[model samples]
Target: MSAKRGIELEPDLLDQRIKTLAELGDLTGDLVATASRLAERLPRLGTAPPAVHLALRLREAAGSSGLAGEVEATEREVREYKQMLSEAKRKYEEHESQAREDLRAAEESAATAGPDATGRPGSPRRSS
Candidate 1:
């Protein structure tokens, strides 16, 4: 018979499904935080030397002079952070997919476990 027809469920198995979902949520949150960190590390163009030199040369040819600032190491930091963030995101997605699958399996197991032994909704409880 189907679970909706009053078959018993394994409460621990259902709890495991909920735990998997919670883990997926945590992974998603981490991915978002990594993205934000990558964004913050991104280098700005106008403040770097190479870009400033190019702009200065262009302005000089056009008979205009402007001050250019020194380069910051933020570009390197940004590159490193971007790569780390990309890898982290990939791992998070993979784990999330696996966790979702595990949750589904747990739900299916709960649905087909057996008739409720407690006259309630769950399987027979075992001593801890």
Candidate 2:
């Protein structure tokens, strides 16, 4: 992919990217799950020293706006990117198939049509 040549989509590279995105999605999902479990299993800290307890800090680390939330967001983004890439691949394959079919049809048509079929100037005509 270069700026001067326009988008040169390499199928192998696209497939690799899709695979990487899937792997990242899985890793992020795992992280989110672990963080969620940590957040859920921890007991709420007592009110005496709300901001001073170690448990509170641990809970905050796994809080909704912390590690768990960030990982969840990453997982979602990866899933979305993978889906879009898959759709693009599907469309490209479909278009390639259609183009091949069209080319075959054109060749067949030309083979079946004799030279005089064009009726153009200087084209050989049927001999009576």
Candidate 3:
């Protein structure tokens, strides 16, 4: 099932998204640490076969291609996405700077060239 959601999508929002991704990465890092310690954190279940089997299963669930692994993978993906977004932001800033420069140059050029048929820079031509 899907529900419609309203969100503002703008260039300025990239920074917020990047920060959110970083925060998500941090959370996943914490999860990985906790999951890695799951075996040690688990209580002593005694020497019975059933207990041993349960302990082993729990350990596998915590470590083997499980919570820890999934968290680590998610962290890596988040970091990668953050890097990509940072690169895109840098490129966008560069292009924006260039565009501003270009606009300033055009304005300066226009100011120098002036208006009307006369060569005067700021003065307008008077009717005869």
Candidate 4:
């Protein structure tokens, strides 16, 4: 492919990857916000004794034991989101590397096909 075409394609691929990373990052942020809200609310749930009592009773009826289990579950979800974020970052880096390679190859090919085939300044070719 021509250097211009390669440059165009690389940007398109990079753009797609950036969009995907942004989406994943947004999802991770939302999950973090949710976990934070839950943590904050978990403490406030203790301030109201009557509500706490009712919540405990409801937890017993629902077979959850207490709010701690829910908190743990949310914590696990947060961990999973972090893992996903790491994976997304790795994939982004890989995409960037591949795009760079593609662009470099295209540039090398273009340069080779141009007039300066030897790519060295002082070399002179023999007559045919």
The numbered model that scores best in TM-score is: 2
Weakest lDDT window of 10 consecutive positions for candidate 4: 59-68
**Model 3: lowest-lDDT 10 consecutive positions:** 1-10
lDDT of each: 0.52, 0.84, 0.81, 0.60
After TM-score superposition, the amount by which residue 36's alpha carbon in candidate 4 deviates from its true location, in angstroms, is: 19
lDDT of 2 by residue, 68-94 (tens): 898898899999999999899989989
Using lDDT, give the best candidate's number: 2
Instruction: Give one digit per residue, the lDDT tens place, for model 4 in 10-123.
Output: 445655665666676566656655554444443335648897886656545333333444554655666566567556667767898999999999788867776456466765
Better of 3 and 4 by lDDT: 3
Off by over 4 Å in 2: 1-7, 41-58, 116-128
Cα lDDT over the full model 2 = 0.84
22-100 per-residue lDDT for model 1 (tens digits): 5654555555454444434424448678977765555443331211111112333444555565555566668778999
Off by over 4 Å in 1: 1-72, 115-128
Tens-place lDDT digits, model 3, residues 1-94: 2367644336778999999999998998888888888845555698998998888888888884888888889889999999999898888889
Displacement of residue 74 (Cα, Å) in model 3 is 0.7
Each candidate structure's count of clashing pairs: 0, 0, 0, 0
Pairs in steric clash, model 3: none
Name every residue pair that clashes in candidate 1: none
